[model samples]
Every structure is written in C-alpha cells, then in structure tokens.
Target: MNIAKHMETIFLASVVIVGATSMASAAVARIGHAAPEPKVYAVAVEGAPMAVVTVSAKRLSAAEKAAL
Candidate 1:
C-alpha cells in the first residue's frame, strides 16, 4: 500500500511538471511569433519643416523585402 501511494505521488508530480513545461513552451512560442510594436519619431530637417516618421521594430532582409 505504501509503495502504491508513493507511485501515485510520483505520477501526479510528473504530470504537473509536464503540464507546466508545456504551458511555458506554448507561451514562449506565442511571444516569439508575435509582431513587434512600431515606433514613431519626430524629425526635423535642416532648413526644413518637422516630420513624423514611423520605424518598425523588426527589419526585413533583402529576400523578405523582395517577397513582399
């Protein structure tokens, strides 16, 4: 009986650890694929007017740009 109880405890602990690990990995995957927020900046040209520029957090490679 004692051995059975110990096995049950071990099984429950293993299940909990696996569940937590899966949840953490899922969250990381979502964050990895998430889009970055765009940044806005105000710029002033020499002897010119002010302008608003938007910068992307992520830059595309040449291949990615060509695919767009």
Candidate 2:
C-alpha cells in the first residue's frame, strides 16, 4: 500500500520486461532468424547524379532554345 513500495514494484517489472526482450533478441540473432534481404534488380553507384535530357541539339523547342 506504500507509495515507495509501489514504485519499486513497477521499476522491477520494467527491468524484467526489458531483460526478457533483450534475451529474445539475442536468441533470434544466434539462430539466424532475422529480417530477409530486400530483392533489388540493379544497384546504383554512389555519388552519381541522374539526368534526363530530352531536348535535341538541332530540333530544340522554342522554349528550350530560349532557356539555353
């Protein structure tokens, strides 16, 4: 019924819950039961910028020629 005792009980319960969760995680990792790898068709190179230019050199649009 005491406040101190109630807080102590709640703190002990939280410690036990966290310990159980950590133990479960360690067991799963030991058994190699982890998240599956994502399927990727292509891998992009690092620090490469992608550009999509659709304007022709000779047949440029009026807007594109003005912008250039």
lDDT agreement with native, every candidate: 0.87, 0.88
Per-residue CA lDDT of model 1 for 1-68, tens digit only, reads 57776998989999999999999999999878777698768565689966669887998899999999
Error of 1 at 65 (Å): 48
Stretches > 4 Å off in candidate 1:
1-4, 34-68
Pairs that clash in candidate 1 = none
Query: Which residue pairs clash in candidate 2?
Result: none
- lDDT string for model 2 (1-68, tens) is 68786998899999999999999989888998668899998778889877578865588799998999
Instruction: List where candidate 2 sits over 4 angstroms from the true fold.
Output: 1-5, 33-68
Model 1 compared with the native: what TM-score? Answer: 0.42
Backbone collisions counted per model: 0, 0
Error of 2 at 40 (Å): 13
